[model samples]
Target chain A: MESLAAVDARLHRELQSRYEALVPVLRHGTQLGGKRLRPALLLLSGAAMHADRTAKNPLTTEESATTEDHVVMATVVEMVHTATLIHDDVLDKATTRRHVPTINARWNDDTSILLGDYLFAQSFYLAATLPSTLACRLVGQAAQKVCEGELRQVLGRDWLDIDEETYLDIIRGKTAELTRVSCQIGADLSGGDEGQVEAFARFGNDLGIAFQIADDFLDLWGDDDNVGKTLGTDLQQGKITLPLIRLLRHDDNAVAMAALDALRLPPEDRLGRVMPLLRKSDAAEYTRKVAESYRRSAIEAISGFAPSSALESLKTIADFAVDRRF
Target chain B: MESLAAVDARLHRELQSRYEALVPVLRHGTQLGGKRLRPALLLLSGAAMHADRTAKNPLTTEESATTEDHVVMATVVEMVHTATLIHDDVLDKATTRRHVPTINARWNDDTSILLGDYLFAQSFYLAATLPSTLACRLVGQAAQKVCEGELRQVLGRDWLDIDEETYLDIIRGKTAELTRVSCQIGADLSGGDEGQVEAFARFGNDLGIAFQIADDFLDLWGDDDNVGKTLGTDLQQGKITLPLIRLLRHDDNAVAMAALDALRLPPEDRLGRVMPLLRKSDAAEYTRKVAESYRRSAIEAISGFAPSSALESLKTIADFAVDRRF
Candidate 1:
């Protein structure tokens, strides 16, 4: 835990200087307060590799791209994550995110959209300068996957007719791909072996899925005040999460049936009542368990990697199953 | 004219395979029958170092990244152009472009926006793969400049406060920056040396400004059928083009004041009428000379380069001042 905190402090310190100039205060997108999970994952893996290097071909402090590479990778991952958030806010017509105005909410859509492009270009440019072709490919592939995920979300909206397999595919593309790449990119860059890279990527993949499902569960069950976003945001937007998908497959209870009916078309202001009805449907518990399963699998994914302090910190991250609050 | 046709033919031949699979509707977008200006500048300069290697570097034949890079750069420049159009359409809310339904007109404000992001990402991913740091830096910087230019446009919009120098600066950022980088990128990859890269970049810079002026002229003077875009689209959007700007500064005529009033606070339906009054004020002729002035300068920028058939072809593109029907 001490090591994790130190690495995170390092990441925050690095991200600070990027704001040397006075950028305008625009509301409505990536307001900079989220889990910082990607950066944490990136730095931890890099730190792990740095430890591994010290045990073998250790650095003489001056030769370190150790922390520097992690910071840039962390910052770059955050940028990719930000770009996705900007676009997703537009798609979701989401008014607020992390308690701040989403870019789509503040600026006219055109400016917000171009701003997203600007960030994406920045991310790519930074990634290009990194030492590995593998890093660039990971970041680039993640970006492409993010776009694909959005398109799938658009196509799947309110279409209860779409299956669980289809739903899982969309979630993986949107949520898990970048997270998986985050681990691979950090480890692979910091001299992690192929085996280590593979294990961490698998861990990230499972964690990303579990994290997203946990968020979905919270959207229905948690207090909106703490979540820092509107309750039933997904349902109002007609996005079907795993819990609802699982619930629909089972009893098809009257309440569940009604919620599904709500998605047969576009939703307009009916969610105040629909939210409670949705809660009564048992979808929340089912979703929580599904998320727990992914968290369990993510922990298992890291088992092949030798037990190290970095692996331990990753276990705490996995313990974030329904446990971490934004 | 014959050379222009040849370049256009070469462009089509190059696009035949990579984007033939693209939806026919989007084909006009990614493969507008423009001269292959950027890649030509690259291939032409790539040959400058060793003319024989020009054959070795047949931009069309080179397999490393030619198809993806060329198409991506082409698509990106067009995407930047399209994002401008989407914003332009929102500002203008005008209906047609290239005589087809604009995204803004075809879809609502929001969808046109996200679609623009989609196109931007697709183009960006293509550019991110080049093996040169210079290429990534150029693309990233140009993208930021485009955003800044648009922001400047939004701010300067009809303050009657814009000066000729400021106007030129705007065009340099909005249009010329991308054009200049396109050539610079082409030159760098083609193995053009430092001096050669500077010459091509200068050529592109001058050409971009000249092209913007010509476009400004065509907005007031050209026939609609030839341009495939509406006449006075800039005026309809309340954009203060060079013609209008010059008239405001120099003309004290009663008609000038009337035109200014219409421009300053334009009527909803009356945007279509400003063109005729603008024409009557002799603004069109003045704008043409302004455009031609830049064209002459652009030709001078090429004088530093050694004479060759490719250089001769490059000159023809700058000659677009008098030759373009639009």
Candidate 2:
């Protein structure tokens, strides 16, 4: 629970043969510095099922948990995460990823898209080996939800009237569902009861929703050096995040429509005028408070999960997503 | 066995809800297409397994000589094929597919990518509900082979020096695997003996390899109007397909190198020179003979399958792939 090193090592071991087969591509393509939060959730949730068990992967030494279960679950979580990023890079027109050129940037659109599907099939190959039907269904349904979220987001892209409900629905699908399933499946694979599994899943969803709200916040207000994303970048892209949505609702002035209309201005000319409009309307503070409320709600949701070191760590991870310096 | 109307209808019926959910996207995206060739193979193979049994699908009015065994087989086979297309579209950077704007083209890359994954998961869900674990494992292994094939293709892209053996390996992984497993799993689901299942699988693999080779031929030699794919498109992309590979030996000559190098030239000039250089060399004739040889091998392979109406239809499909006229 303290760190994901053992799970990471086990995942690396599973990837050994594939990594070798795909050495040149893996070495160059899949950068290896991710937090592996999903895998850790899987491992930790597995631990929570066996009372008083430490959440760190025991696959390192004399292992009790099935090797296939642990390794497959870990790899699947990573694969799902990677597949999303592959698509995300294209959607965001994100040229740089992990300080390296994205797959789309490097290989053009087709190969990048196909590679994402390759990772997906690889993930399914891994998941199909799990010991439980429940695990398979859980993973399958989560994947389905993620697609729904993506479809909604695509529709929302140019909707200038976008609001919190649509935004929340997008985040729930995009971010929360997989995180929930990751923990829930790990618990199921570990022989956990339905109640415990459901609790962990709920915890994951609430945390993910809050985590996303904060990410939206950082896109506007956070320091660029620390966040590593440009401030007001979302505005420049003409996205109506929580703050902008709130500003649209809060203003009662004569030029409110004109101020809202500014979002449709050319992206290159966006930021200069929008920030002051936001400040005059008190929208930024209102948005931050909404995010903070979601954060508190996230903490409250996990209270349904009983006390454990793993539960505590989950809380800490959520807090770090919002409050960390970097 | 003949046209797979019953099984195809069943697959359509079972997938109606998911397809309905995807309808808006599908209308924009076209999952409807040319002959559902892969699903036909699966259904025909399934029919061969239980020659005397009565099976039925309520969705179809077609009087099937073979029952619902083909239905399950068809669904699973289509899932695998659809999964591959989703991935391939990404790899090919194909914005338009089956005469419709592609999912990747209509939706941004991420939605299309995830939708593919969702389909894959749905395939596994559909596969797991069937009669055997062996079927699941067979399909799983085939999916892995696809991943390996794609990764290998990326590793060897634009090599120009790639030989026939390497090309065969890539094609086997990319195309033949799902065909092999599709036939195998279908037979097994319908209670075919071990030898019968294995034999049918081998036949399907050979057929798939032959079909791909002929398709490659069509890409080069057939009229653009007849083939529908852009003319000499593979050469333009610097893809080292069979003809391209065979021609490279003669390509050491200045005229050939001029054509090979023309990929970097202006698009019109590039095709003008490359097309004639390819035609003048023995590459076209050599690849044609190779495709004929594979088609012959496929016919020979099916000789081991138990003789039945279904088996005869399967043989016709393979012949249709290689020698048929549009």
Candidate 3:
């Protein structure tokens, strides 16, 4: 958490520019903080490997210098996340996020759209300033995947028959790929071995997928008071998440019809009525199982890496993804 | 023109990807096919230097190898342009571009926004793959400027008091910066001298400003049939351009009031009434003179480069920016 605060400071320092109108929005996006999970994963990955160096080779100078690169990357990954959030808010027509006014709600859509683009360009610009093109390439690849995935989800709206494979593809692109890259960048930069880097990559991929599934679960069933934002948004927006998909795959057409009719109701009332039906089926339990399985894989991924406290932290983080209430 | 066509072919190949829903929109945006001026400028900048190499240094293999880089950059720059066009369509709510339906019109705004972001990521991805970070840095910087400029324009939408200085800043960011980078990339990759590269950059900056001014002129006064898209769109959307700004500086309050009122009318009738007032004030002529001044400077910027047929071509391109009817 202190490291995340440091990342926040770094973001403020990096994004504060003379573009008078642009800087405030950049600051707002960065400061409208979420869990800082990605930054933490990245930092912890590098820190884990750095801890490994102490027990193994203990080369201080080059390893110490790479720590700064990791910090820069932590800042960049957060900015990338913030940019996507701004754009997603616009697409979802969300009025608030993290109990704060959404960029689209505070400003108009044009400004929101352009500001998202500005943040992305700023992130890439910062990425270019790094010593290697690896970060830039990875970030670009993730950005492409995220956009493509978002488009797929947009096009898939109102289609109730979205299969499990389609859901996996969308979640992998929209959420998991960036998380995987964040971890890979951290490990790869910290002089991680091939196995160590690959391990972190796998850990991040599974953790990210699990994270999105849990997040979707929260949207439907999480505490509205503690979540600090509107719930039942996916249902309101007609987004087909895994739980809904699982519920649809069941053979009972009558229950499916009732669920569909409930989804068409207002957001405030739909989740209340839909939850009972969702619970009557095994959909929620099944979704939780899938998420737990991925979380287990994520924790298992780092088992062969040199043991460190940061590795334990990674396992704890993955568990948090499955176990958190919000 | 053949070179521009090559860039077109290259864009088709580069943008063709496995993301089935995204590829068609990407193709549509790239295939909309404007003047391809940015790509032409890029290719000519590289070719001009290559032609100079034959006369001066006579290095063959490595120099010829970079021609392909030029082609790749040509495609990247065009994709960047197309990306901006896609976002601009969403911002402007335009239905058609270059006589075809815009991506925003064919799909929804969300798709257009995501596709614009996808193209930008793809462009940067391509930039990163090149042999140097110079292109990536230039592109990131230009992209940032373009977004900032667009945001400034959005914030200044209905503000009638936009000064010439603010206007210059906006256009420099939104239009000139990318063109400058395109040419600078071409010359830099072709191994041009510092003077030559800077000259190409300056040439592009000036030519781009001139091009935008000419385009604004066309929007206000060019024949609608020839322009092949909607005319007087800037006025219709309440966007203030140079000609209108110049006309507003006049002491004739009654005329200014009449012109402003006419601009609020339907697109069909606004130009009919506003043009007389604009012509009487010589604002159109003033805008053209201003454009011609930049055009002259653009030609002057590259005059120091070694004489070649491509240099002549660059000169002709400068002339065409001023002299073209469409």
Candidate 4:
């Protein structure tokens, strides 16, 4: 938690600039608080790996990672995540995020786009300050994956046949890739061995997939007050998420055809028609089941690490990834 | 010229990706042929510095830069330029660039924004592959400056008192900064001493300012076909460029008040009113003179280098920066 506080402080410092036009927008974007899941994962992974290594070699005097490195890397991860959220708000035309007006709402789409770009560039600038190009390379590659996945989603907005596998692939690139890179960077910087790094990456990937599924579910069914943002946007945008996909693949032919018809209607009307059908089917339960499966896998991936508070936190995060309403 | 060809090939190769949704947009963005001036400046700076070093020490066995290094750095610079253009098109709502439909026009603003982000990430990924983080640091810093400049321009769209110094500062960040970094990276990678790198950066910065001034001049006075893109966008968008600033500062109080009133008119009508007033005054000549001054300064920055074909090319580019129609 203290490390997360450090990340928050560092993020504010990094966002500071002489450009008065960007300062207010940057503050608003970062202050629209969500769970700092990515940075927390990075810090916890570094702590767990460091503790495991130290436990294994009580007499060895290997140098552990400095708190500065963990804080910097966590800040970098959070910046990338925040940039994507700002751009996504522009694309979705959503006004509020975390119960606050988004950058796009408070400013404009042009400002949102430019602010996202500024944050992205700042992230790379901070990453390059590290002793090696490893962080830069990983963050760059992960950012590319995020864009590719978002592009795929935008292009496939009208498609009616998006299935479970395609949805998984999209989320893997869009959400899971960054989390995977975050954990891997943490483990590697903390001097974890190759296998430990790979294990942490796996944990992150599964946790990220589960997190997105929960997000998709909340967009469909959760209370707006609890979610703290706009809901039903996925349905309005004709974004075929796991629940809709499952509902469309219903066993009853009439139900399936009706769901297809709902998607074909105008965006404003489609949500009303689709929600009732989704509620009648087992789609919500099915979505939760899949999310829980991924959560279990995430927990199992890190089960081999030596028992410590950090390891316990990682497991708790896996549960939170699928269980949280917000 | 062959090196430019190599830069083109490297750019095409770098834009290749597994995402089918992005391929066509990336191709369209990159293939909208601009002058490629940034990459050319980089290559010329590197070559001039290399040739000067070799000539100065014929007996020394100092290694020269490989073609691959030049090509990669040039590609990185061009990618950054191309990315900014795509995003700018969205902000300007310009339908055509280089006589072709912009990505935003052909697809949409969302696609253009994501594609720009994709290219930005790809540029950083490629930069990180180099032997050092120098390129990443410089490019990241330049990109942040660019966004800052653009943001300032957007936020100042309605301000009537934007001065010459503010205009210069905006252009310095939005346009000159990237060109400055391009030359700096080329010289640094090609083994130019620190002083040489700094000199090349100055050359780039001055040339970029001259280039932008020429661009503003052409936007108002040049034929649309000759400019190869939509013109008068700055006037339509209420962008206060250098020429416009000079016009507003004209000694004739009546003319300055008329120009201000024209800017206050609706965008569709303002261009016509402003154009007639601007043509009646010496604003065009003043803009040209300022651009020519920067051009001379750019040329003077590199006059100390030893004589070579690359040096001649740099001077020619400085001339072209101010004088070209497109």
Highest-scoring model, lDDT: 4
lDDT of 1: 0.64
Candidate whose DockQ is highest = 4
Residue A225 C-alpha lDDT in model 3: 80
CA lDDT, candidate 2, residue A245: 79
Clash numbers, per candidate: 5, 3, 0, 0
Better of 1 and 4 by TM-score: 4
Model 3 stretches with alpha carbons more than 4 Å out? A1-3, A59-62, A251-253, A260-273, B1-3, B59-62, B251-273
Please, what's the RMSD in Å of model 2? Answer: 5.0
lDDT of 4 at B234: 82
lDDT of each: 0.64, 0.67, 0.83, 0.88
For model 2 the local lDDT of residue B2 reads 47
Q: Which of the CAPRI classes, incorrect, acceptable, medium or high, describes model 2? A: acceptable
Name the runs in model 4 displaced over 4 angstroms.
A61-66, B61-66
In candidate 2, position A315 carries an lDDT of 72
DockQ of each: 0.31, 0.38, 0.70, 0.77
Q: Write the per-residue lDDT of candidate 2 for residues B1-326, one digit (tens) a residue.
A: 34466655655654443323455653443263457787777877777655523323224323444455457656766776776776677666677655667777776555566566666666666666654444555666687677778766665655576788988988898889988887876676666667877777887888888888887887777776666667666655566788777665674687667656766676556667667778778887887688778777877766754467877888788778788542
lDDT tens readout by residue for model 2, A1-326: 43355555554554443424465444444463266878877776665554333244334334444345765776777776877777677767877765677877876665566566666666666676654455555666677677767655565546677777877877888888888888777776666566767777776787677677777877767777766656777777656677777767764764466567677788866677677777688766776676667667766765754467666776777787666532
Number of clashing pairs, model 1?
5
Put the candidates in lDDT order, highest first.
Answer: 4, 3, 2, 1
Range of the 10 consecutive residues with the lowest summed lDDT in candidate 3 chain A: A58-67
TM-score of decoy 3: 0.95
